[model samples]
Target: MKLNIKPFFIAAVLFFGAFTSGFAQDNLVNSLKLNASEKSKDSFTFTEVINIENTPVKNQGSSGTCWSYSANSFLESEMMRNGKKPVELSQIFSARNAYLEKARMYVRMHGAVALGEGGQFHDVINMYRKYGAVPQSVYTGLNYGTDKNKFAEMSAVLDGMLETIVKNPNGKLTPNWDKAYAAVLDTYLGAYPANFTWNGKNYTPETFAKEVVGVNPDDYVELSSFKEYPYYSKFVLLVPDNWAFDQVYNVKINELTETIDNALKNGYTVAWAGDVSEKYFSWKNGVAFVPNKDFDEMTVQEKAELFNGPKEEAVVTEDMRQIAFDNYSTQDDHGMHIVGLAKDQNGKEYYIIKNSWGTTNDYKGYMYMTKEYVKYKTTAIMVNKKAVPAGLAKKLKF
Candidate 1:
């Protein structure tokens, strides 16, 4: 999909920074030479809906399980939106379930699939269908005796076991392999609850899903953009974390942003999977923006200042998006909820992202990102079908 990015450029910075000698004069004449200290803001506005409420600030804690943390949070909001009180569902339960499923797939495919501490949004749905879910209060996965979800020891053991099993040193594999896998899960997360009570009612996991949380697993859709596929067509998003390879429709960048905003305006929240490694991504300070100047142009002293202060320039472009992806610079590092939009002290607009990293940061687990930052960084987003704009929805046939 062709992403419209000129609207995001604060000025006519040298396109791609690749001016030929013949065009050098023209390039220098028109090249945006604004100082790194100068500032500008986009002229658009947005408001929040799907009001964030009672979101339990759970920590993933040294695990690459952003997928688990994020989707469980998504379902929590789903419960709240449906008039049930909000609940902090156990992300570790979902994570354990997904790990077992992934191990099965890995062995079945002879280890072709990448297996690690990563997964996609669909993993949560699969967990809901396969093993169901429980509130964090029920099974916190703290059996390892840690206060937070730490998977280093557990994941290493699981991966080693799967690798050994996949090799199948014997000519045949054991039929009880699945049982063995479940045994490992039981050890880590404790046994799944066969029947439990909530709000003075008896319920199993499946019953809780059907009667209480009431989230339709099929109601959500994933969307992404890349040139390899036809725009607005469904394709398996080719990311390692997307182990399910669920087909997500490709749309232009503007449409993606539009869908997110429309969803927020209409009282819906979005599950955002994106890259958070850029220097401008100040999760520590709870802000993200594109500085207008290049880092190479700054002196040693000024470059140090760039780290200490807000960058006014950082020559962002469509190609930088491509380069980052191609060079492995942009990656599916984290998942968060885009809960609202806001303008910074400089009047620059930023998408208000609610993160699961706890309320330790200056903004208490929230980050503000500009349009450029979102475009360059987002890997994919899942939102309610109703969140899609009318035009974009019709294009994708909703």
Candidate 2:
């Protein structure tokens, strides 16, 4: 969803310009400084605390293909960690299967479930189980001949198909509704092979899933934090993209980040789902941070200028995460994998993120998200249970 933030940006700038003269700071980085150097020195150090393993980032272009890209990347890492040859599983293949499945579900629910450019991580796992998967080179889903996914045209067509089915224009649900949905997918992303040869043997999608993508679907777990839910209990995440109603473990927001940091420190990667719509999220700069509240204590004009760029703070907490979600500040925006940790020039901790948008940005498709940013913006995270601390693992019933 490309938002029009021009007006907001302009307003924010004018609001801040009035204070620039009063606070003629020495350096650009120094001007936006929220915490004193002395205060910052007391904050946690990620490199000193956690170990990380990472690879190059990937890009999913303009499509809502992050679900596939991120999950497949996680699978790739799983293969690597397990000492198997890493293979780029076809994201489009998983996408086509999910697209068809979601359409059927939409018709079943009479268009109640969302039918758009978004989905949950478990959708990939579920689709892989039911329809199997393919290699990237085998099914890229670029029927229009572009190198990357540009789904605007096809999405409209698919949306139209689902809308038509959900209406039941003919007044009777046909048994072949799913077939019609599958036809639309086949037209866009080539027909799935019933039997294809790979590695000198015939294989179907199910067999390929069983043999190639060896990670067990049951091994992965989703975790989130929200005050309404009882801590240490499991509940379905209420995001629209979670069409499967997948249950995620609910923890206190502090525990969520603690577990994530602990997992990364122990050399385990996390599958992350978070909101990326904030102005502070600079994909080009490869950073995500929360605006400084202490700086906001400044005059309105001063606040506006700082808002135009980046500001750092440590207000990220369990309550902050819940309040953001309650106030519609955090949303289900994008998904990625946090593979490592790094610090900025200010020495603040940042989780090294691998995005699915292909290597197109200055950070080559990665984002360094701060601890506060993760606390305030995350929707959910998936990590291996073994990576969690023994105490936390016991609380989670792992």
Candidate 3:
């Protein structure tokens, strides 16, 4: 469904910032910076069928802002895909702006909606459209005394303040409440800079966005497949972190993978959000595929050999996908970028996923997710409308 809305800030569910010095320079190691023996012994070796260049891997330390990191990484790739110079956008700036808006919404809803660090892919688009963009250097948002993001305390404090406002002992709101909220964010993230110098030039976030970033926010659309919603109709996704209640368009299950394959084949990357909570989703080995046998039923040897390479996987049917979603096996657990496609020794297809968790995995923070895993666990995807397949585009009225 690309209705229009798009969490964790990945497995609590996963995101990206690219091209500064470390990861950015490291990204040029190979298309994926693979070691000759990147895979474990007996593990699958992938030859990339389509490798779209993107910025380096990012580490979203101690925070659940993967939605921002992943979407911004997709946007960075989008910039590269369009021939713009690579620039890493600030993931935390989006987080800063979103916290303000989420607090306001929480008060409006009388504290009914869930509010925290988790968000969907479209939250980045919403922030970009509303506040424009800035380079990561312009607003690193590490002002709270750490070299990396650690949101546990800050988010809790912010939530506590919002809950107090919702209590409304005065039975009325004060104009300065939001101002106080902004001050707290400022204290932590530093004020969203009014203007900043970049490449020896002065520009505000909006100008930098228009002149440098050059992304057309409206060109992107969010989509998901759910049996509960009618295909091709716009419906607001009911997931808890989608506090804004943004809409998404629903479609048949196979169309989900078909659309992603078409986009990559045609030189576009996808912002993938879905369940990464499965036991078979081995982030360390950088491979994920559904086993034909259930996890609990697997023998010890079968479990040990799970990530050793390619194997037959259960054929995911529409009913099977629906069952996972209905029973909560499929959830909005993490977000990642789908950069390319690859196949194992047996010729099965896997999507090359760029994760935001850093280079801890075998593929240097890049991993291979079987198409079956994506089709079964995907909650939503936000992709450029121009990349939409021609026939499917018409069917969804894109």
Give the number of the best model, judged by lDDT: 3
Residue-level lDDT tens digits of model 1 in 5-100:
122222221111111112211221122122222212222233332345537556566566667788788788878777888878888888888877
Error of 1 at 101 (Å): 1.0
Q: Residue by residue across 3-103, what tens digits does model 2's lDDT show? A: 11122232211100111111111111122233222222223233433435444565565466677788788877777776777778888888788877778
Count steric clashes of candidate 2: 10
Q: Highest TM-score, which number?
A: 3
Expressed as tens digits, the lDDT of each residue in 352-388 for candidate 3 is: 9998878876788898999889989898998999888
Please give the distance, in angstroms, between residue 119's alpha carbon in candidate 3 and its true position after superposition.
0.6
Model 3's alpha-carbon lDDT is 0.78
TM-score of 3: 0.90
Candidate 1 vs 2: which has more lDDT: 2
Cα-based RMSD of candidate 2: 8.5
| Model 3: how far residue 360 lies from native, Å | 0.9
Looking at model 3, residue 278 earns an lDDT score of: 72
Task: Go through the candidates in order and give the clash count of each.
Answer: 7, 10, 25
